[model samples]
Target: MARRKIVRSPDLMLLRRALKHLLPGALLLAAAAALPRVPSLWRLVLELLPIYFSLVFVGGFLLAWQFDRSRIALTLLVLALADRALLHGGHNVHDVVALLLPVNLAAFSWLKERGLLTPRGAIKVGALLLQALGVAALARAHSPAAVSWLSHPLVTWPALAAVPLSQPALAAWLIAAGLAVARFVTRPAALESGLLWAGLTTLLALLAGKTEPLLTFYIATAGLILVVSLMETSRSMAFDDELTGLPGRRALNEELLKLGSRYAIAMVDIDHFKLFNDDHGHDVGDQLLRMVGARLLSVGGGGRAFRYGGEEFSVLFDGKTREEATPVLEKFRAELADTPFIVRGKRRPRKKPSLPLPAGSQKKVSVTVSIGVAEPDGSHGTPDRVVKAADAALYRAKRSGRNRLCT
Candidate 1:
């Protein structure tokens, strides 16, 4: 038998994904870490960094808006507004705003985790309004001496022991770390990864104890996250089937190269698909294919389904024999036949003057599939050859009787 191709392991895949999202931020962090070493560069960067950050955040907001990512746009806007306030505000104003920053970030992360904020325009507008009110309140309000405990050495001791961060800042860092771990373990989405990297970069900047580098890293990380998100979206479009939401032929080809020894391949075709398409409208035919694809997606026996092409699907049973796969294929075929597909009736224009008008009544239709199973053996030495054998067996099934299986 042909040897399986060396493929990336799960840990390797996860690491690759993390690195892809973190690379840009990593570069920014490196640049920021080096800035304090040179006085002239540091001064120059400090003088111009605020302007650069302002433009970056503004441009990020516009891009997010254009992409209909309202939540992200609002986030960028909030960051921009806070940055501006900190740059121009007095000491008391800075302290109040700085205290609010972590609380806001943690709350936003919580809302995102629970899926409460869905990037809707109304939600974005409301959030922005609330942020504006909070900023206004902080601007006019004095720091309460009653809450002076917040800045006291006693209150700061515990946080300092853990990290050289304040309470609110520590809380925000913890929230970001938790979000990143959850995302990597549970879902591993691009946006989540980006947010995690951005958060880490923010924390790193804070640890460096430099104001200019902090702002610079913040803007750089935001821009990188946006770019990565767009790249991931485009990749999804290329790999996923638009109609059935299954992996397409290209995906199947890639998967085949990764299979190990002792696997079974099944070629499935809808029975009399062309005749069905001709009798019913093409739209109805498309619906039938969709239904079949959905059913194949849930196939058991350790099988993974792919939309091979029009009216055909391929199921691969990793580490299975023909005997192991046949029963599962039979079960799927039987279930498909038993389920009735209902098509709502519609009035059609009369083709001939003599023909009477048809009544609008719903019609029930059923579809059946013929599957052919083949396993790797001496005769079929390669995956492609095994697929061909399954295809030949599929033709045999069609010839024997439309809806039967052939091994």
Candidate 2:
């Protein structure tokens, strides 16, 4: 009987990875809800909140620093201080945080990474310290003028006015949210997405408005999002190729560990890639890799692609032999070979070309790929051995001819 084949896709692989990282936080929130929400439990959670926040921040900050994620490290520092200032929520703590959180998120989210021990890092830290002190000073000088200033209505709409956040705070949140969305749309990344979600999570906590159990739980969940985001960011750094945006060698190895018996591995190399780099430049070489990687994403026969290393890529066809995978590779190679790759002049704009090109300056470069496919054998018992066999086949293909596939 044929066993059920487990398909592996970069998308599904990433989804599984994300779920793995998020499960603990979800379970923690669920467990909090599963237990009684009475006064006794509230007291215990509230008392322990300080300890929990301390450990998470200290540990998360160290990890972020070690990973050299200055953005994440600064964000952690800001949120922890905010929690200390506003977690208890008296004397307009909610109002202040609502007004300030969005601005802080936008500001810190976009700041480029400066090392923690550097002068710029000290300035950034000082700026945050000043903000925290300002919040503390406002909290202490809780007179009528200060209270009204913090709670003044910026939006007069009935629905918005009724929410826990003051009209002014709501307005600020809206502006900050817009900025966050714009920044993300223009330059999407892990931290921007994380901060956007974390802002929404914090807003959820703010909506509960001093409600026992739920408020603290949501706050903790928000913190967890920030912490886990750093881990995810680090994970991407390791597992994904930064240039081509394909799964890196590490991800390929991880996938190989989960393979079934009937699977074919195809090792592909761009023909004369180094010639392109040497004649043109590394930039042109980069463009070729990107074009190839983009095409590989839509490969046929249910093959998943990886940026194996350098100008080489690997594709895995689950539940297939070399014969079955050949047609797919043939199609891909034919398409790539037929496509005209343009080498633009140095001054050419990335968008519409501002100036006309000189004749023969920008010309089409012929591109081709050599591929080798292999399946596991009794002698080649392991995934690594199968890959080596595939590599040997690839070398044979290259030797015989530069633009062909072998099995």
Candidate 3:
């Protein structure tokens, strides 16, 4: 009996990552939101929770920034500080500044969408500094007239402070919500998902006429995003090949376990790889692997490629027969042969060059690959056996000639 070939769905992968980052934060916020229902606990903690939340946000932001230098963390930190300043010192100023919060968040989303604010860019830093300074100045300004002038339209128009459905604030929330949705649909990045949750929490807090819950939820959400980001980053390091940027053997093994029927497996090896490494040096060899990996990544015939240990690769074609996979594999092999790799001469001389010392050495090297394709046959009933069959075919191809395909 044939089993289906394994395939990883991109949408499902995105959903899994989002849930990994969001579920914990969602549960924490739910608990925090419910805490205020207990009158005694609410009164006891109300005065202290804001301070605690502020500290949590600040500390969490610092830790996350240290770990990953996240731009989102930094942005949230500045916003949280501004929020605290407005709450404590400037009641009237708070009204004015709160009106602007949504707009600032929307602008941040816009900048991120445009690629202007990246974790590595100075522009984000400059933007955050400007926002902090602007918010601080507005919140601390002692001029009641200026505060009233700025606040009157936002505070008095339609009298929605209790519901926080004012035009400016409402517009800001809408923008943030819209950005969050766009991110989930288009990118589904961890940071983007966190921002969406934070935005929702802020909106709910505004509607509930409470600050403590907002602060609590913000802190929990920020911390959760940081934790998830760190975990995901670590997992990638473990499962991804750093040199070639392909999923490693561990990922391949995982994929193999999920395979269904009628799939083809191809074992690919670079021709004379050890000789190339010994002659050209390890650096050139690494470049060759990267080049081959890039080609394999874009393999035709709906193939998924992986680095299957040292100097070896695997391509999985789910729901395809060997006949269907052969043309695709052959095309990949031909492409590798046609692409010439340029190797620059090293600055320092080495003992015993791998290739014959050049009489006017040509810097160009042509790379070729030997491939062995296998499908489910009576003898190869399991995934493991199928892989072994492909490996045996690979050896045959190498034995018969260096750059050819075997089945």
TM-scores of the candidates in the order shown: 0.51, 0.82, 0.52
The list of candidate 1 runs beyond 4 A from truth reads 1-55, 110-121, 142-149, 153-165, 208-210, 238-407
Model 2 clash pairs? none
**1-407, model 3: which lDDT tens digit per residue?**
65322221223334544575566547656765677788888777667765666566677666656655454565466566645654465555555555666665555444543232354456666766786677667655676776554434444544565554445657667767887678666754555555556566655555644364555544444444444544555576788777776789888888889988889999999999999999999987886777677778779899999999778999999899999999999998886777666564565243335666555563667788999999998999898999999999999999998689999
After superposing candidate 2 on the true structure, give the runs of residues whose Cα lies further than 4 Å from its correct spot. 1-55, 87-91, 344-363
Score each candidate by Cα lDDT. 0.66, 0.76, 0.68
lDDT of 1 at 393: 95
**Candidate 3: residue 261 lDDT (0-100):** 84
The TM-score, computed over Cα atoms with residue i paired to residue i, of candidate 2 is: 0.82
Q: lDDT (0-100) at residue 333 of candidate 1?
A: 87
Tens digits of per-residue lDDT for model 2, 320-396: 88889999999998878876677655786665456766767766777899998899988786889999999999999
lDDT of 2 at 220: 64
> Over the stretch 1-407, how does candidate 1's per-residue lDDT look in tens digits?
75322211124334544666556556655666677678898788678775667666767666666665554565566566665666555455545555555555444444443222454556646766786676667566655563454444435354486554456556656765786667555645555555555556555644544364565556455554554564564565676565665678888888889988889999999998999889887877776776677677778889988888889889999899999999999998887777666553345331223753354443567778998999988999789999999999999999999798999
